[model samples]
Target chain A: MDKSLQKTEQEEIESKRKVYREAKEQTRKNARRLRFDESNPQPKKDSVDSPRKRFYRQRAHSNPFSDHRLDYPKSPESMDWSKYYPQYHDKESNNMLQDVEIADIGCGYGGLLINLSKEFPKTLCLGMEIRVQVTQYVEDRIIALREQNKSKDINYQNIAVIRGNAMKFLPNFFKKSQLSKMFFCFPDPHFKQRKHKARIITNTLLSEYAYALKVGGIIYTITDVEDLHNWMVEHLTEHPLFERLDKQWEDQDKCVEIMYNSTEEGQKVERNKGDKFIACFRRLPDPEI
Target chain B: MKHPYQNIVSTSTHLFVSVQNHLQAFDVEGNLVGSWKDTIGHEDLLKKQQLEKIEKLNQEPEIKRAENNKKVKIPKIPTPGPGAPTIYNYIRDLELTHDNKYLIGITDSDKSIIIFEINLNEDNCLKLIKRQTFPKRPCSISIADDNSTVIIGDKFGDVYKIPIIGENVPEKDLKPILGHVSLLTDVLITEHNGKQYILSSDRDEHIKVSNYPITYVVKHWLFGHDEFISSMVQFDFDRELLVTGGGDDYIYLWNWYGNKLLSKYPLRDLIEPLLDESHLPPERFLHEDSPKEISVVKMITMDKFVVVLFQKVNGLLVLEIKDETLHLVELFPLDYPLIDISAGGDKIFGLSEDKIITQFTFNGKLTIDDKEFKGMIENNPCEVQSKEEFYPLYTMNTLRKRSEH
Candidate 1:
């Protein structure tokens, strides 16, 4: 029995190495294709379209303009989360409650999600992004990470990335009290007075966030702009369902450490020696009327 | 440059400036007269009380043991963000009544449309006459000819006609008069050939003219703009002529009565030189070599010229319409992108998003003393002197006109 177990372990290690090699080979081919495309540009119609144009076109066609069905799912249960995180698809256990419990809004390039996945391996996490190519790159990165770490039993099956406007489809993706943690890192500070309503954190949007978050859920926000940082702090501090967590608690939190250093934007800011302002708020229980 | 007001509406002598949470009226000479701030509504008071209660409960550890009920509706308390005071509660649309006795505005905070009676005799005292909440947030509002009725167009593409004289009506009592099935950008009530019609534009590049009061009957659908139509205006002299500016890099002229496209003014070259790449997002798609599109925010038309404000372009395009030809007048470059502009009695005011109000003459002359405007108290009353100098950052070349093939 001992000899048989040892043989099986050796086979598993060999298969894992093969998967890693195959993933590396696929990445190398993707790089080569990108180079070829650069040398001789493709004639695809979408190749000429910039990301801003694509973003505007997508917004004009979604939700209030066209059918909300395209951007929003009626219920979170209807969405197949397993397709995004295939390694987590357990065939032996027929459980329906297993789902993404953490979300990163506007997770550009998804550096935080990748880091947090390793810290909380059992918990499912999702990165929601609006840009198409950025989301695709993140998806590919996760696939590669999963293959490379298959042998170590610390694979990136807990994380996934999806391309969608988080502002419009947040409730569609998350059920009530479905999320334990939500993160907003390095959001675009609209700066313009008229465009403040387009901000991710508002009194109206906070209600939606509170509805999706568990009673004890935590909201983490970090930004480089002092004005935007103060704006987020004031809004979150005044929200009835949220209470600002103690600074000491945030300093000790492992997630906060990763949030400060893990994201692509965070690293860039670090290199520039830019000051990062972080604020965390815990969702209070519903008020007893 | 600072834009003290986000939206400015003008009569002949009175300029109703939308400041923070209230509407402040200024004379043609730029002296502060009356101010109007809407009182907290009943629902808003309840929301505030609930917030205070929650704060108390969260502070005391022993009282937190009480079981909380999830079914109770908790109202959202809008917190004033850290920036300019009252940043969250901005006037989405403000208009002066036909008689100039009342100033009406739509505030996005409580989704309330408030009417303030401006009594110039009593030191410009403004009394809140009525405040009504809408089912959806209103983007643009137009007071009717009689001033008793107002036509409001919402972001959801629904237009509703509510009586300004009536008692407060609940949300269920109010219904949309007409809808476009797409996000409505601007709405106008105009009389053409002795008949009233509702001229509306949307994000889907559609401009529809329908008979007012009986708006279900569509009269004309002008389809030329390929993107979001941000602003539209009817010529003061000839209502037949309509001008529209949008996400597309052109200003369109239309003869609405005949439903014909008269001329298209290409704005790409005029605005290309003013485009600052630093203002754009740092996303991968916004990298160098990508074509950028400039959008028009608002268009203000005077008798001889029309001033068009482009989004993110800190400059105003002064265009002259002579006979059937549209000629470029001059480009006055500003330090900041203005939010709203109002013109009356040979004076024009440009309101910036940074709370700087830059006043100009009808001939594109910067009127404010630069030192005082940048250093003094922003909200205090100050005399605005028009400098005889007309500084042109760039000379106006001939307009590059385009036509549909």
Candidate 2:
């Protein structure tokens, strides 16, 4: 073949390669959206022990967004899966053992969700917001994370924020001993006498906390409200299933980190140097009747 | 009954929505679970109100400092009652007449605007009396140019008028003034070039100046920026020139009477020096995406600096309209959505959508001579509308000279 012809063929090959590469990138982008977050997930197992081991098994796969391998809206009687599922699992990342499952009872702006998801990839954290605007925010953040390949490593899959009420739905998602920890940080401290009945704390509620936890599970709470802390202590103590975690143990508590790094409200509470109070309680063994 | 969070997975626990107050979460077996107290039904605002009571008492001659110091702080009780009404899911968008008594404020719940009669006793405190409710969630309200009638326009583009000082007149008493289809975002009672007109701006992008269906004059429709039309004002100092801003980024200025398009006032881009000392802060400011979803979120004016809310920027703002352009002044402390802001005489009152009414000077002062306000916030207890009354035990500032509607 002549030299000119050979050069023309070389140019054609280069252009074809460029087209192939663009097509491949397009395919990958499409796949990212279709593939739910399946990254680094541990199969449901009998080992309720070994938080670290559980972390690895859960983090064994890769996908930016994952739905715990369960279908969205696991049941249709309540929230529509279509609206709730699209943004469940966020950017897949390396799993880490420190990750623990968290439920942000009134997650206002996914600020808490983002913080917890990164802090404990081993933990599956959820932000529950009632306001559609804020709830949709968390849903988007999870998607952005997955699309960015933010969650690719570590020992566990970290987060799944839902738009629902922890007060109304706690029973729906969690069972006795399911959550190793519970965080009621910066809850409303209803102050009026008639409204006192509205405070999230009461002798009865403390019992609910006791019932939700495992024999050894712990409840961590914080507030800028000094009076509310007193209310929490009173209720937590009166309940039969709980005991105040010793102050010594309180300082060493790992859950404090999540509370400190929570969403907009938490940050606001922190900035005002508002009177902040922290409380911790453990689920004591149910005694003989 | 309202939860701003999701319902967790099913367990035996359930709290009936009807048992709204003082409800604790209980498993299906009737075992008490979580405290509904902490969630929707929590009374944090009440506690904050009581703290205000103590603060107010701290000002009294009777509650000696030593005596108050010695009294053990009751964690739950803030005060027995002399405080701002602790309202939940209510409406707010305030328009106070110059004297401050004839306040046209709206309650967001039932979407009603009320004209309240005001009286300030010896102390410069505030009192609201003779409340007449209208059938509209008012975005802007103004007393008729003659001061004979109160005109209020709702989000749904209905403007109703009631006699300012008169017998309780329901819907029949109302005269349909400015009727349109979409939201009528603003209404101004202005006299331009010697003729009086009701200048109304609506979602339809038209600002109509007229006496209504009888005969109408359409102002030049401000046709440029596109977004939900929010607030429109005839600059207090210069009622002829109009300044209007809304969901759109730009604030447009129009000749209030000539119907001439003047200029556009835009929020500082945070990068401009015009933002001055009031430059948007880096942290804690409400991010852009938060407030736009809900329209009619801010209420502003021109004479004083135009106060912008944080729903768009997550901060309290001041837009100083100069040469028809906006100069972003220093942002203030008020957060979330500012429901209503009114200025007249020597004071400015900012009422939050959450029922927080903050009064301050053009400069800044923590305390005001609210001593004049007798029966409104400082003295209100359990009140009866037609014939009911609630008398609580501990009373201090609760004793007002009292007035009857």
Candidate 3:
């Protein structure tokens, strides 16, 4: 072989090896980004890219009865909303400029929060998820969106996610009549009769929800399980503090439409050709004794 | 093989002590006046309830599938085997009506509230009038101020109201007026400004105040605790003040009607020195280095002093209320840990381990006067297999919610 041809072959091999090494390094970086470091949760400088859903996958069900270690404020006055909404913090008063008015319980993958962030740009929205990894995924997703839109309008700073057991302590995080809207999109069915108490919607838990919600506030619920839908309807209707909203009301409501299509669970149900049942209830004023 | 008194209650003429399934009444002179033991009828009732539960459990899957109109495979209900026979049925939560005309006690064997007519003059001082079984074990009960109604709080977090003199309502037809998702620890009926209120506390550290009969109207939640609440007491000197204690290291003083925390009296500093190896977390925790925890077992208000008992600790902590704050007055230690405490008039009776009763009175100082009732309850016949059999006496610690997945 000629010396020039041998030199060209050597150069080609060197370039191919360099490409392999760079690809390996990129894979390593992605893996690190996916791993959640609970102690050091700050996002990396280059985390502007969207997180891969497959990397943040977790079990869909969590037992509400179990003693899950959760961090929550003792009362609404003690909750430091500034940590969640840093942009809304007022330095002189040492508090957030506005309270979170909308809450998405069991916000799986946070699709609804992302959509609501743009729809209600002025309102602060919070997503509470019980599962740890899923909550971290949503936190990362929001951080990346905010970083991507750093200089643009609607920077995704209005939406945040927190790990919590919403069933145990709703009043601890929100003051009496603090919330304007609450969404329960595609909650766990808990089909067994013995496990019915563990369901999100019960006559007892409704009182807590009513306490946290304003008199005119709305509770939006949607599920693919017909039984669960009726269960929610029956319980909400039975509660004196809540009244079922008419279908016509649901048809005109903005949150109802967003809830039906924006959640990851809702989208999955849609793809499977499942029937989706929706119910809306308005919190009623307390009766004078 | 002596069994400690599981519960104690007092009236002007008689002192009632329950040892396992046997209840004995003693006069002021330490003479046994009347005695009654739980009959075989209670066992029969328990068996019937167990069978009914199994039947219900077996039918549930079919009912759920039909209601859903979906083909879903539900897990099969396991049939429990006849494993062993144990004498765990004991009398708990003994109380007397305001008029002292009736005695109420909860029997665990059948999960029934037994109401007996009290007549100290008759040869049979106690006469069983009604035995009402509940869907779940009744953990705590309170009588209405008018004495017309009895409020029962069960282990499943349901509070049911039944007329004190009415017929037994079938369990299936009974409805809970109010409930919590967590296990109920205590329930109390109190009145302020002529309006009655139902105060209920649960293992989730929630103290809910609701309007009686209109239990749907939740007035507010007293929300300062971070651990399970085991005991609660209302001050007689000031009806507005409420004292509560539990798994936390502190007891709280609150104006429950106003939903305000007046003070938190720290107990960890006093309890930490009394902890032993038995105070370690359950064996399932895997973590060997976790610190010991305290569980407040019982509390009673006596005049201006609030007396508290902790699980597995051989002592009573007396705190005095002054200037809207609780100050530790005395750490009254005993030879054995007290399993239960009750107050009548100005006297406090603490039933300790191995069938011991220690009487106490406060006249600017904590004084013990066990001479009258010491030998009276020692001869009462209730059996215990070993020291380990007293584990139930310290079960308040089990209410502490573990962080395991």
Q: Which number leads on TM-score? A: 3
Q: How many residue pairs clash in each candidate?
A: 6, 86, 0
Better of 2 and 3 by TM-score: 3
Candidate 2 lDDT by residue in tens digits, A56-165: 11111121111112222312223332222334323354222232245676666666666666666555676665444345445444544554553466322356566554
Better of 1 and 2 by TM-score: 1
In model 2, which runs have C-alpha deviations exceeding 4 angstroms? A1-289, B1-91, B107-113, B122-139, B168-173, B211-220, B271-296, B302-304, B312-314, B331-340, B344-360, B363-405
DockQ per model, Cα: 0.03, 0.01, 0.42
Provide the TM-score for each candidate, comma-separated.
Answer: 0.51, 0.36, 0.87
Question: Per-residue lDDT of B1-405 in model 3, one digit per residue for the tens?
Answer: 687777888864677889878888877566787778887445576467567666665667887868888664443444446885444677878988888888898988788898888888888788888889887889998899888888999988889888879799998888788888778999999988888899999998889898877787778889889899988898877888999999998999999888899999998888888888788888887376777888898888878888898888877899999999999898887767888888766667778774467777666566787565645656578766887776376687669888766
Give the candidates in order of lDDT, highest first: 3, 1, 2
lDDT of 3 by residue, A27-123 (tens): 3345344433325454455576666565556788998767788888887888988767778888788868999999999998999999999999999
Native-to-model Cα distance after best TM-score fit, residue B53 in candidate 2, in Å:
46
Which scores better on DockQ, 1 or 3? 3
Candidate 2 is scored at a TM of: 0.36
In Å, residue B139's CA in model 1 sits off its true spot by: 1.0
- Candidate whose DockQ is highest: 3
Chain B TM-score for the candidates in order: 0.78, 0.54, 0.88
